[model samples]
Target: MHEKNAGQNKGERHLMMQGKLNRGPIEFKSRPAERTGAIMAISTTNVVCVPPTMSICDGVSTMTREGFRRLPITDAGSGQLRGIITVSDIVDFMGGGDRYNLVKNKHQGNFLSAINESLRSIMTEQVMTLRENDDIEDAIDLIVNKRHGGAPIIDDESGVVGMVTEHDLLKALFQGQSLLSVEDVMSGSPRVTNPDCSIAAVAQQMNKYHFRRLPVVSDDVLFGIVTATDIMKYIGSGEVFRKIQSGDVSEVTALPIRSIMTGSLQTTTPEKSINDIAREMVQKRIGAFPVTEDARLIGMITEFDLVRTLASR
Candidate 1:
């Protein structure tokens, strides 16, 4: 994917590397002087991968069942890394972006047939990977600058050995000791969606803004939360298949987000300490928390925000 800009001028290449190809200018933060052990200690070893032959529906099922945001694809016989599929990619395939052509054109508007397509149809062929020799700071710099949430860790001979993500980095940085408060790192007035919004709209917003999750609100009160994973689960778990008879992608995406939103929320306060929030995140296995004030949505404290705090510190 990085090679796509090889023909571009130096200045344009810089923008591409800085993750400005489609989004706004990125604010690169942090070069944690942390040791290499920091990343390896937190990375998920014995990484799970799906074969390229796996159906798209089964691929999503694997991710949902495993609580993973991304899944690596490997050659079934050689075990060599082939590609990767993330929640974002699934959203794009589900009608969020141009990738929906696989359904509209390739499958003749049949959502069911489109989903049954092999992961190869939607998987990212050229994945950005982390070599085993790379250090924690190197991982941070690469992932942040690329605007990727996580990456598969590759070894020269063994192929994929582990996986690391912004969430993992954040957990390693602060463990209930930092003095920074949530307000210091939390992004205020997070982009929100409503329950009545269609899955297509939510997916569009997520793709456009590069948001993995959006708080679902009604008349300024936080009602629930919707995430890319949730949408994937809706399909992977057979809920969407059961709800639609026509098997058209629009028939599924046209449904309100409320159909898949998570109403139960684990919230935080702006005045809360980052360390405490970190502890809560680890305990709850949650990546981001909604910051509320007087029972109203105020802001959001995410793994990236906390990771930024660690970088600045």
Candidate 2:
């Protein structure tokens, strides 16, 4: 997610490192006019959290079922925020290894044997949470900087309050973009997959295209969809990284996507108002929603696409 924000205009004096967007040796100062007044946006008290005792698998299920990209872990009895599990953490952990031994070991053993591991195994213990009184601008900056998609908001006595997300900010900005139908802004004939496609292969495409999700299709029929977050949940909790490390490539990559896809889909229409679509996306916290008409899947509207539209406008 370290990609460019949809609305950033690299005015001048901005130098980008080759391709990897991690800021390089460039430094500078800014004037008072640079501030966009992005603070104090989110102030909701509704949030969803997972218990520490829940299995990582079940936790993954909860997030996908509820349409969340990250889940804050809390003490079941104390209701205190513990930590968080995110797609970045999952991908980072799965992507590491001292190239030689890591790759060598993975090719010879069953890397996926550890899929049922506990949540504590992969969850980040040192979490940076919002204090409710904290400025939402800071969260916005972090998101723009590609640190996280969302931040968990906390309350007095260390209880969970709510979460502020990049999508929420995008929702506010997209309402002003030139009026257009969903089809006007959406990517039609999107890349799709089937129920039997291997998760490993699908994951590669997602990483390559920086896509969050892909619609699942079979025999020219759309049934459901899979996402990067969903893949992280599967590989992280299931200890599939262990398989990747153990060199059991064949076994780990054999698992079908149907085991993880969200079968029940929420769809939009080609003629639907983009305003209504944005509101629904913000409310649901889902990045990609299929656009259908007359019961046929035709297009996809993603948060990235929305952000790009806002940028163009």
Candidate 3:
């Protein structure tokens, strides 16, 4: 494995035991020019995937266990790529979008029964993928232009050979150039939420704005932050199952966002360089940082932002 050969860090080591590969906190040392090779140089090979016939609960359980935000579904017999499911899809099934119909109409408000349904019901049938021969620029274009979190790398037989994500690309390009500051790349005036927002409402906002994480503010002060991972954790932690006494998902989704919001935060200043922020992200295992100035929330920076910035370099 690339990670094994590269002397993977503690976080990657932990994930390795769970069959996950090529994730970081990987240290970025190679210059952008030297690392410009096949996308496989950075992509995660031997990725953990689930069969299409897997149950929804089992699929999500694997994701939660592996700390993966997305899982590719493959054909059991041939291992050909079939579909992909993400935490966003889980959020949607939990009342964020039309997929909630399975919980309401099909399962008749029975969360247990709904979760037992086949993974195919919620998996994204039309998946965007990457060819093994595709270069890094191709991956960058596909992710940035299409707004994909990641894509599976496939071979001539259309079988998944590896996986690449924004994190992988960021690690390859963040060479401490210090060319762009956080203010230059961060999305300003980010869509935010209040502590009182319902989990369902937070999910809706995430899907609506295409944001993975949202800053929680109240009275001009940052309270906490919530992300699709938080929602997925709520379900994966077995808290949702324990809380659902009558098998009604509404009981769990009705809880305020504050109940699940991450109170402790890691934030950054506007003047910080994207290079510095990228290093911190890898070291701290953080996906995004809320930009603060004088203790006030202003903007947000994430792997996507850094990837966009570094890809240009």
Candidate 4:
């Protein structure tokens, strides 16, 4: 089975290295230093935000429709940091059947009323926050370690000032800014595959989509991730698969994906700080980490994504 998969993977890599997918039509060639300079110069006044009393429904509606993940929740009266509403938070609430049912039943009300019914009851406090002068590294750490998607930028008085989301992080990376969030460069609805699927099948999908990794899922639960590196390792190891020119094997056909996949995994939550996550990636020498809530996969963050964020900064 390994040998059969190896042959298929070799073909996939050849195509990829040949630029057969044409995935980089918009590629930017700028270096990281230049991108960082651009992010540092961006003014904070234009950041996206919201008030704490605002309903979760409203936050979700705005964020979902606008493709945002973090909504800065401030005290309506004082404009002070109260909490934050993130896509992961909303997903958690939705997973708790009762809240999901309630929200589904009341989707058509006025924004405020819908928020009152669906979000206000489920929103979280104890928000992780950052100050304006805080280094970008600080925010990155919070997102990576804490699994936070965004952090509300506050002042010495604790008044809500500006907001930063993963999108902002991506902007920083792509443009060379100081700090960034998960929302900054996370690709929504990324390609995924089952852990039991054949490497050949996965390789085909990766080649087709021009993806670097595929999140591994089992029974709708995120297990780990498989990347080009995994395939390359299997090939270079030689022991896993030997080159076969023409012989057909009848016995090696039913192998499960778990047999070849890396099982022990590292993960992050949307609430973690990017700095912490980046550190883990460097220390662990891993390319990507899965994002989970309640042990279920929600997303995957990769070194490429981080690189993009750094480029934007």
Candidate 5:
């Protein structure tokens, strides 16, 4: 088993280092890289924005199709940042359904009618906004504490500039080499397991693979994520087992992963940036994020990964 594990580790490392080594001076540039007085030199031109009066249904649809979890809402005429929308907001609206059902038959008791009416009346003004020059940490705080997934970036002139999301923070932390998409550093194949796996077995897998966390999958669908923190939290809580004696059953041995795993999960995609990932970790007070591709678990990014990447540089 030890030899097998060693072989696996070697293979994984080889796969990771397969790319060519480029020799050059690495340049590090961040949004508001160097604060220039009250006016920050924020990257704004490439921001994606939509009209404030647009239907929420349409906005949700667009985000889902584009694999974006957040988008900025802007004024159509003045192009001013109004607010932002997120996957959480849409998920809350849909009540955790796989797909939002907006249409319904008349016999369904005004389901479609209500949805239509709501869409017609709903607008982006109801959400919040942040200034472009505002510290990125401030945005992180708002998103984590307020449960917002995205915020519209605005200039001192109150015009819409760009948008920021949790994934953006992940990108910043893991892939700091360029302003490229988050997908660049995101892992395309992640290790996953079922919640029903035995604690000992799971521990063995983690030790064997050197994984900090594993995405919990059910029927090939992502349910949530379980991390080393979760395991430690469980042990620390002492709700499972207090003490063990010789010939006695350890409390942890009898526990199931689902009993202690965190149900509320925050995730990201491959298209985010490393700086964004780092910002997210600081803001959300989380140590890691499960990276996904098309809603499928692919890889994970953690504080350790960021530290290792930085050390390598």
Candidate 6:
């Protein structure tokens, strides 16, 4: 055992046999160049939120008015998290078969009333949230793996402050790619949507790949497309996605993917500059531009993919 004393030099006791009591100069190798590039903790303190008591219609309207995709549902008084509501959740409910059947049967009034329900009724009560001081990498991992658009950042009191999103992550890489082109970073082969396919099928595919949207393709022709937003728009009709999640593959459950898929699409070409594409995505608040070749869909360049590529460096 080594004798211990703060005043004693390190290894002094071992060197005592040599009768050298004085301390020698310490030789230190260049301490690994102050390792950097570690991600700092991210916060979500400035995120928009809604009260659970608010009607789904109101919440949805708020999301639209504020250009938000999701909102944290909080207690009115306590300001504590109660649940979360996304455009997707609302669309899932609205696009359900029962709701569509009602609309088809000349019962538009009943369909209208359904959307007036409280956010608490439709909001996901079990929300996955990040603390104000959570490591950004952790948030990125959770968001990417779980396919979340973004998550609420909660304060010490559990109140939402802001969000940490793919947009923020991608912003960090704008400087990293000085001359990379869309073709260089784009996914050469992307999962596409088939018009004849069921919405359920497409949704499952989206879930499987954590895709935000899919390019609609049929007979090697690129048509419109389906986005997570497009799906959310119909959620107020029916909870079709939920049924699809529960393993219901019947036709009634296999709602037409074409019905909800967005008809107008924004596309890019292989020769387009990556910086130009990034600017467009950021300005439009959209994820990617389907990379097309000779007016045919060839690939995609999404924020998720962009971030992944940059982070790898």
- Rate residue 176 of model 3 by lDDT: 50
- Candidate with top TM-score is 3
**What is the per-residue lDDT of model 2 for residues 1-313, given as tens digits with 9 covering 90 to 100?**
1123355322101111121122233222212112244334543446688877676556666775666678888888999888887654443333322221232253333444333445566677777766766664565555655545677777778888888776865665654524566776778656666778776666555555556677876655667878777666665355555445444645565678787664368888777767678777788777878887666677788776665555333
Q: Compose the digit string of candidate 5's lDDT tens values, residues 267-293.
A: 887657666777777677676787765
- Cα lDDT tens digits for candidate 3, 51-155: 988999888888889989899999998989999999999999988888889999999988899999999999998999999888988889988778898999999
Better of 1 and 5 by lDDT: 1
Candidate 1 C-alpha RMSD relative to the actual structure: 9.2
Q: Looking at model 6, which ten-residue stretch has the lowest summed lDDT? A: 11-20
lDDT of model 4 at residue 7?
45
lDDT of the candidates, in the order given? 0.78, 0.60, 0.80, 0.52, 0.52, 0.61
- Which candidate number maximizes lDDT? 3
Better of 3 and 6 by lDDT: 3
Candidate 4 RMSD to the real structure: 18.0
Which residue ranges in model 4 land beyond 4 Å of their true spot?
A: 1-44, 96-118, 174-313
Candidate 1 vs 6: which has more lDDT: 1
Ten-residue region with minimum lDDT total, candidate 4: 13-22
On lDDT, the stronger of 2 and 4 is 2
**Model 3, runs deviating above 4 Å:** 1-36
Per-prediction TM-score:
0.86, 0.56, 0.87, 0.43, 0.42, 0.65
The candidate with the higher lDDT, 2 or 5, is 2
Worst 10 residues of 3 by lDDT: 11-20
Clash pairs (backbone) in predicted model 2? 106-245, 106-246, 106-247, 107-247, 111-242, 111-243, 112-243, 115-238, 115-239
Off by over 4 Å in 1: 1-33
Candidate 1 clashing pairs?
A: none
Off by over 4 Å in 5: 1-177, 242-247, 310-313
